[model samples]
Target: MSRAITSETKHSIISDFKEITKIRLSVSVVFSSIAGYLLGVESVDYNTLILLALGGYFMVGASNAFNQVIEKDLDALMNRTKYRPVPAGRMSVNTALIIATIFTILGIVILYTINPQTAMFGAISIFLYTCAYTPLKTKTPLAVFVGAIPGAIPFMLGWVAATDDFGIEPGTLFAIQFFWQFPHFWAIGWFLFEDYKKGGFFMLPTGKQDKGTAVQTIMYTVWTVLVSIIPVFGVTGRLYLTPISGVIVFILGLGMLYYAIQLYKKMTVLAAKQLMLASVSYITLLQIVYVLDKFIR
Candidate 1:
């Protein structure tokens, strides 16, 4: 009976760790870093790739863990986040903080093995996400803008890891992800307006579900689409996309734009959710397309 109880406890602990780190979300962010690395690398370095994946995951996980610790009370007020490890009483704040600290240290060290610039960016991402973005969420709508900086870094961080240089190529990658975030997050803010209000979060531009917010969503979606195809102009250095790839990217952008337009026209939760999904698909597929274009061309 004691052995069975121990096994159950171990399973529960693992589950709590996953919740604290937001494992799935961290893995997706790691994917973005890997995609960037693949685009910049002349030849695949399995060792660097593995290090990037581990370092990226640890950095993102640390950010998420710290975020949960900082927002424990607010998270408990919101239905969507109320059941997270810290907020739901499955884990203590100190435990989560310790895990976050360890992850942050390990992440920086691992990324440093790739390059100092990569480690520097990783440290900056953590600082912005935990210090700048987390506290600002309840204070103003601009938190999303601040949050986008760290959120976009992972995409370009891999490039810096591969090349150990910060240049136009990585800058363009950063810009593409940066603009994409506004619409993606605003759509989530729209659908979760009520839930966010319960936690005193001013996520939307006007702090309510209305036309002004929808218009901005449409505007940013347009920017996201435009920035994504800028590589075709051959100004992004080694990041140039072939005409065919550019066309495909434009079509994908249009698909996401279609959802954004629908969200504006409908002004419903379903439309917002659809836009959110489309944005996720758009970013993931965009990364894949960029990597494939680099290899094929």
Candidate 2:
């Protein structure tokens, strides 16, 4: 009986850890970082790739854990987040703080082993996301802009990790992901406006999902599409997107824009959800197209 109880306790602890880190979100961030590394490196290095993935996981996980800690009170008021380990009493604030700190330190140390620049950027991402962006969520709608800086860094962080320096390649990667985030996040904000309102987070640009926010979403979507196709012009040096791949990417971008426009026209919860899904698909497909274009060309 004692052994059975011990096993259950261990399982409960593991579940709490996973909840705090938000494993799915961490994995998504790590995926973007790996895609960036693959796009940035001239030749793939498995060792460096592993280090980048591990470092990204730790950094993003720590950020998420700390975010939960900081927002615990507000989280309890929202149905979507009320059951979170930190807010639901499954984990203690002190425990979350200790875990976040340890993970962040370990992540930075591993990244430093890869390259100092990568480590520095990783630390900056965590600091910006946790210290700056999290607190700003309730205060201003511009918080999305601040959050995007760290959110977009992972895509470029991998390149810097592999190359240990900042250059045109990483810059291009950053620009692509940076622009991609506005539409993506705004769509999410549109759909989750109610939940966000409950927590006092002003995520929409206009503080309401009106014509202004819709227009801004479309504008950013246009910019994201334009930037995605720029590599085909052969102006980005080693990053070249062939004419065929460029056309395909353009079509994908148009598809995303169509949904964005639809959301604008309707401005319903359903339309916003469609736009959200489309944005997610657009980003994942864009990354795949980039990788395939690199290999095929």
Candidate 3:
């Protein structure tokens, strides 16, 4: 017997598609790449910016889809992830694989139109994320480090797309985002420790929420703040910031640092959650300040 799909069924399918692609997270990643592009370009090209947004979105979406597929079983074990499309039976592994593959191809092709380096880096991010970082989650806490590589690339990937060159400017951008990930992710791990344990995933620096992890979080937060302000020293080449902008950035870093210190002193899940939210806001604001400073000055 043949059955026609209802409007509710159609909406549910679309919702599943969005969930499988992790649309919101992917869009946030695209924003980072666009910010990087804006920082590097002398003038904006609306066409290229559009292409970068689409390509960046596709690459990140592909990575998330593949990650969901790979971790579907483990995801089912964790309360936070158990309702994701694949684990919840709203989408099948084969369907997710097809979507990921399509996204990967489209992302690479679109980026290649910008430059070979852009395409190459896009491919590398997807490969390292799906092949290396996803698998390492269960085995070691160092997976966060591996994941940071791909996570940080989007910001600098825009620089390469803008100039088709890799140098100190892009390198500095990468360093800022790279170092930021430790404190940010560690805070997330701290608050989600119990949920992650159910999935056998080790995400904390010391493999547990204790003083050691708090200390490491504080250490990395310091490092992230230091790297973020390096552009003001006039050593980062084209990435230099004005005195006023530099002060603003330093102050922003201090705001995040305050929360990190709080996490260290309290060692409570509440403190960790606060730090996590602070870190997220900090990065988005940092990118905005950098872009606005460039144009306003």
Candidate 4:
């Protein structure tokens, strides 16, 4: 006998759907790509911008859904992920698979309307994230390296979507975020070491949050800081940072570096968590700096 679904139940399911897709993270990804697009475009076309946002969101959401599907069993063991739709048994694998498939097709089709190159990178990001990074998480710490490739794409992707060219400008943008990920995600790995281990994920650099991982975090944070200021030198043609904005970027990088140093000195979960939040603030502020710098100059 079928039980008639209530309005409340319907809302709950819709919420679960959103949760399964990781709407917040996908939205942030779209924002990064749009910033890239805006930086590349001579003049913004609000219509195409809207489409790019939608396309980016769907593609990233699809990748997240696929990751959940692959990690459903593992997710169930971890406290942080155990309540997720897939692990909770609220959404079936087949149902999530169908949604992922639909999203991937829709995303690629919409992105293709921009250009073949844009669409190609979009597809490649999904492939590398799901196929390479997802499965590799449990196998090796090198997964972070693989994951950063796709992670860095959105910033460069925007430039490609706008210009359809792979040049030093985009490459420089990619490098900034590429190095940024080492410390950003390593912080998460440090704080959640036990939680991740419950699910067999060794995300920390040395598979543990030791001095080795701390030293690496500090090294990458330095790299991230250096690259963040490079645009002010005017080498990246499209991305110019005035002296003022360059100082601001440097200051924000220092804020993140401070937390990274704290994580190293304390080697405690609270310090690692603080570094995680600081990394988030660093990236958000850095992106804002880039967009504002573009306009100020």
- TM-scores for every candidate against the unseen true structure: 0.98, 0.96, 0.97, 0.97
Residue 234 accuracy (lDDT) in model 4:
84
Candidate 2 contains a number of clashing pairs equal to: 0
The root-mean-square deviation over C-alpha atoms between each candidate and the true structure, in angstroms, is 0.9, 1.4, 1.9, 1.9
* Clash-forming residue pairs, model 3: none
On a 0 to 100 scale, what is the lDDT of residue 86 in model 2? 89
Candidates 1 and 4 compared: the better one by TM-score is 1
- Whose lDDT is greatest here? 1
Question: What is the full ranking by lDDT, best candidate first?
Answer: 1, 3, 4, 2
lDDT of 2 by residue, 1-297 (tens): 999999999998998888899998889889889988888888999999999999999999899999999999999988889999989998999999999999999999999999999999999999999999999999999999999899889988987886787888778888888888888889989989999899999999999989999999999999999988998888887778899999999999999999999988999988888888898888888888888888777
Error of 1 at 102 (Å): 0.2
Model 4 scores a C-alpha lDDT of 0.91
Candidate 2 lDDT trough over 10 residues, lowest sum:
161-170
* CA error at residue 120 for candidate 3, angstroms: 0.8
Model 1 lDDT on a 0 to 1 scale: 0.95
Best candidate, TM-score-wise? 1
Model 1 Cα lDDT, one tens digit per residue, 62-97: 999999999999999999999998999989999999
Writing each residue's lDDT as its tens digit, candidate 3 over 191-291 gives 99999999999999899899999999989998998999899989999998888988898899899999999998999999999999999998999999999
State the lDDT at 199 in candidate 2. 93
Better of 2 and 3 by TM-score: 3
